[model samples]
Target: MIWDNNFAVSIFPILLQGLWVTVQITLLGTLLAAVLGLVFAVLRRLAIPVLSQVVSFLVVFVRGTPLLVQAYVAFFVLPAYGVSFNALTTGIVVIGVNYSAYMAEVYRSGIQGVPKGQWEAATALSLPGVRTWGRIILPQAIRTVVPMLGNYLIQMFKDSAVLSAITVVELMATAQAIGSSSFRYIEPLTLAALLFLAVSYPASRLVNRLERRYAPQH
Candidate 1:
């Protein structure tokens, strides 16, 4: 029950290791989400009838479904179909895929928020589609959406703990395991909370600062 003996001696190391796993998953998953979401956003914006419809359906399905269910399906169901991934990989894929749907929407909104005049200006300049988007639209859209993307990153970080359900040994899972084994919940659970607070608080502040810095001036 003592704080010094239990927390500092036994629980800190285990929680620290778990935090590392959580950070790894969050970073990898966020990268995947960013890449895939941007692809989906661009595809949808292109308005290619069949391809657009297919991407729309995918985004809707992923966004409509629960992430935990996705995790379970990835880990438990995929093996029956001759596709199997390790728990950690499955967790990353599930989290990344789930968030990509939402991030796609975020990206689409950001892209669309660019004034129609910009697109027209690019067209009048005889810029190719790729060049126009790359040079004119994407830069502004990305700057506008950076804060939202950062918020998603923080959310992803917290949600990575859910990977423990599949035995991924992330932060929450490590705390649960250590607490159960040692029959001491206070120290491990407290350590996990502190770790989350330590990262999330600063990340949230950074997101706010980004939003302020990028806000369009009057």
Candidate 2:
């Protein structure tokens, strides 16, 4: 038979290990992206003379560049400048920062969607800027954008495969390694695709559910 079920069963455990690493990268990368994206969104919203413009430019630059190239720079070039991280660490950060540029726009849209009355009410209450944002504005803004963030989380999970190029032993990397060693690409590669679909399809459904749950009532 062309497909070897016994071999697939044997390699299942190893693939699971790589999947775990992929999950770690996705979770940590999304967390980092969420935090940094919020910071970027807030900085640009503040409209600080030069700072906001610089942040805006950086966001655009990151968005415009290819992620694979960025990963190469982080993995290869940064070490030359005395900035270095292990492959896994570099992958997580590069994915996070790459996603952050996109998330910043999502966050900006959320923040802008806040009711003008909310801002006026904050002013009338004499709330400090930080308190006004922390207490009133951000909570509402973040709620509206939660679904969008979840979508990005799903996207980053799939995109993590790109990090395999830099030797981060993710699912795709594991599959490739198995193929190279065994000269049998069919089972491992097919299994990897199935594994990805299994996770992403459910996650997308959950995101859709969240979108319905959080949508503003007419």
Candidate 3:
């Protein structure tokens, strides 16, 4: 009764469009995180002089800071320095960079878990360094970490709500806009919750299934 039927109906389409933007940000951000994370993981394993140390410091800094602050810095503060980006791009970069640090740790553990014997075998066979990693080490490490990476993807999806703070007009932002304009919080906020649950729940189940399927076979 607080919102007229017409207003509620009209807002649904707007929210759905906003949801599409959220999905796009999550997908692109996850892709970037996955690639950057793997690169960092491999670099950490290589322990290449100062580059490894710098990357290690960066990973710690990103993982330590709050993501909302990062979003604000990327969207608001960067613009003052003549580094302007649209809301969606800012959201993607912030989330991707933040999660990449966490994913890098997950990947590092996976790579380290590979038996030393495997590396020794590659060396004994006179395999080139790149071929050894690409053919032997990376495949096993990736299988171990895929589930964790998928979980990070889900986490990024949920965290996309934070982008609302930067005026990204994602699902939560759209909900807030509709609620503020119409003075009805229940329907729009409730709908956003349901939409997030609908996506996240299934994605989580898929992650579990992947973990079970790809788990180390002893």
Q: Candidate 3 — which residues are off by over 4 angstroms?
A: 1-7
- Residue 80 CA displacement from its true place in model 3, Å: 3.6
Is 1 or 2 the stronger prediction by TM-score? 2
Off by over 4 Å in 1: 1-4
**Structure candidate 2, residue pairs in collision:** none
* The 10-residue segment with the lowest total lDDT in model 3: 1-10
Q: Tens digit of lDDT per residue, candidate 1, span 1-218? A: 36756455667887889999999999999999998999999999999989999999999999998888889999989999999988999999999998999999999998988999999999899999999989998888887778888999999999888889888989999999988987888788888999999999999999999989988542
Report the lDDT tens digits of candidate 2 across residue range 61-122: 99999999999999999999999999999999999999999999999998999999999999
Top of the candidates by lDDT = 2
For each candidate, what TM-score against the reference? 0.94, 0.98, 0.94
Q: Model 2 off-target regions past 4 Å? A: none
Per-candidate local distance difference test: 0.90, 0.96, 0.90
**Clashes within 3 Å, all models in order:** 0, 0, 0
lDDT of 1 at 168: 95
Could you tell me the lDDT of residue 25 within candidate 2? 98
lDDT (Cα, tens digit) per residue for candidate 3, span 1-218: 65466766767888888889889989999999999999998898899999999999999999999999999889879999999988888889999999999989998988888999999999999999999999999999888988888898889889999999999989999999988987888889888898899899999999999999989764
The alpha-carbon deviation from the true structure for residue 51 of candidate 1, after best TM-score superposition, in angstroms, is: 1.5
**Model 3: clashing residue pairs?**
none
